[model samples]
Target chain A: MSLASLTKDWAATSYGFLDASAKRELRRKMLKAIAVPGCQMPYASREVPMARGWGTGGLQVTLTLVNPASTVKVIDQGADDGVNAASIRRFISRVSGAAETWDTLSASIVQSRHRVPEEVMREDQILVLQVPNPEPLRGVEPNMSIARQMHADADYGKLWLTLYEQIVRKGRIMQGAAYPSMVNGRHVMTPSPIPRWDVPKLNMAKHLTFLSAGREKRLFAVPPFTRVEPLVFSDRPYQVEEHAHLTCRRSGLSGYFMNEIPQDNGGSTFEVSDSNLGIKAIQKAEGAPTEIGETWYRDGEYSA
Target chain B: MLTVAPPDAIELRCNSTFQALMWALSRPGDARVMPEAGLAGIAETLVDLECTVFADTPDLREAVSASGALVTGDVSRADHVFLSSLENAADQIVQLRCGSPLYPDDGATLIVAARHAGQRLRLSGPGIEEPTEISLDAPPAFWAMRAMLCAYPEGFDCFFVDAGSVIGIPRSTKVEVL
Candidate 1:
């Protein structure tokens, strides 16, 4: 079916247990978050049958933002069927029964993972991110009192010391994941682990962005035209990973990131696979002539 | 990606996922999300962006084909990248195909799954009004590598996914050592 019709169908679904009044309340709360921009506002986030880490925050926002005029696409790790994504899609389908898809561009409401879709999202789209921990200071001090005071006063000289310590003690900077960032030139906000590639996408985008944590029960927003800066030390320097070679193994494709597969005798090395929706390419390359939902695997896990 | 845990390793994934969520939410600028597979997941994780998890897409046969029609490719250009552990994050940082200066945001988002959230940097930036610290229990090998990847305007974004939640730190913000 055409995307337009599919989207039309998707909007018909309900937005979970939220009544019309509740939805309006959520809408009002979200607008409040957006209007203030960069401030955390606690909302009445519901506990879905799904777990805390499985996008309860995003689903709530989707319900609040979704309307008869929207098309929703939900993905986990950029793929629509990555368990969590499937759960959300199924939930929306069950409640709202709105047309659901993996297509990025076609979606007006998208709940995604650390990685954003390959298709660039437009301003019209509202991206909702799922969050677990909302505090950057938790790891640093382990004391909420200290952390709250640190932020209340902007006393981050220790962050520099930590990086310096990495360089001093080990000749390097010492952070791996959950790297810190400064949001809207004032408040530092988590960009919802949407991959570094997607991280920069948040820079100067036309769309309004929202982040929520059902478990934490905190919500924040990045209004249009706001500056989001990732944390960095001048002497240490900020850097993103670059590929020595970009090639996928299974599909014999290039211009795509490769997942290193073991290539040795007993073990192997790094290889690559399609990131998302490569079926179109696969069918063409292998003459596998197929369409969506046609399961052809020998292992027989998929039966669509 | 090879999975040591069963395909049903949902609980373990849950534990690490919360770690990941913390990092992602704490560090607005970083990327943290790991696949169920170990190293295989790490190396091939970025492929998730351009790849699909069809009911049968991982049919090893469908995966290894060169059709580009169903699902197949090289590991150079994916934006949604994955890593086996936060252990390999340092190297992944230097080699993950982060986008150019013009499209810096186009850099691949790397997912590094680890055994646990290690205690490491005390990160303070705009996210923390006063100050904030992040503890990563990534293996010492990870700590042994070049620690800092965040540089103003250029750096690999990261997501540290553990069992419970996720955490992130992109390359755009400034970090201070506590």
Candidate 2:
């Protein structure tokens, strides 16, 4: 092949902010990640404008997937307007010319940190989760190589022991976020620090989920219909955060995960963690025509 | 104000090609349409200098080489293996790298040109919600070989391409012949 055929004209910046080779490498890793569900795949973890730990992994995946036609939504801890979420969303739109939205129903790709949207994601939608730690064995094993060996051996005895110890000490499973879950009965993966409430939404769900940790330089995926069972003892069942009874003070919405706000009178006020969902509830209450998609939870109950 | 750069033709093609391939694999047995026909777009979208690929066709080898990837003749050494046809592919399938249990990502990706209709098979696994059946123009022996070779995370993945349509059968997917 001629050198001229391989070369292209210089551009100020590559489309989607990632060079073609980086995208190609991600594409290859992603396919492999999908092939072996929940198994962590190592990647080059190309440098982005943002810092490594702050959603860089999710940003790289989203950038690889984004195009002009893609409608992107980014959230940090269930809020769309948080500084991290807003900046990520704006940066994605600015670089890729993709449509930005706060509504979960309208988004084709949702890049999230520590939360999954309350709305049930469709098969067409993809969820990219920003992960600080991709290794579930990191807590039990300090050495990464040993942890990988444990993963290969499917040796989760230590993880179960940790949970067992927590039960003996706290009388309940005190693991709040990033509860370890087994995917496809093969690999135990941390579902990216999402709450126990959000973890159930991933089990046998319709949407594809990618959990990526930039600092760790690893990525994994959970395809639709895969079994994501939270590790729980048979006698003691899994429990979500006790936010079901609380109501959002502003929107009058209840029966969903809520963010508790401490009050002056030693009381607490609650707001729906999904900010856009609360906003839509407020709009609908005000007689404004709004479309809120069906959610995974209903009436203080976990229902798909 | 930042003016977003419009995707060039190559970028657009790779983006769409990857989209199709991603969704196709995400929901195994579902056919997704690519922006362009044939294996060239797939090669452009995924294979690069980091990969070692084995393409049976001369044109595909040239295309892969142009992409600066090592075009290997050994199927076992290839991370990506492309075959124009699956007929009499039992030997090659045997040689395809299934990767080690420690590093399953080393498993080869086998892309074959096969018709969408032929032998009826049921697929059940990670991507499939309910057990779904599809017809493919491949010998039942191929499925048997795949079943024999694939040991969960250790098995190679496959893509069946027919003109503009592609279907992915990841190793996580269990293929049952009817």
Question: Could you say which candidate leads in TM-score?
Answer: 2
How does residue B97 of candidate 2 score in lDDT? Answer: 96
| Segments of candidate 1 deviating more than 4 angstroms | A1-15, A169-171, A251-274, A280-304, B1-178
Question: For model 1, how does the per-residue alpha-carbon lDDT over A35-153 read when each residue is reduced to its tens digit?
Answer: 33454556777756678877888888776554434578887765676777887876765554456766665677777766555445664576787777666666578986676556545
Interface RMSD of 2: 0.7
Tens digits of lDDT, candidate 2, B1-178: 8788889999999999999999999999999999999998899999999999999999999988989999999999999999999987787889999999899999999989999998999999888988999999989899899999988879998999999999999999889999
lDDT of each: 0.51, 0.94
Measured with C-alpha atoms, the lDDT of residue A213 in candidate 1 is 78
**Highest-scoring model, lDDT:** 2
lDDT measured at residue B164 in model 1 versus the true structure, 0 to 100: 32
- Total residue pair clashes for candidate 2: 0
Model 1 chain B worst lDDT window (10 residues) = B2-11
lDDT of 1 at A113: 60
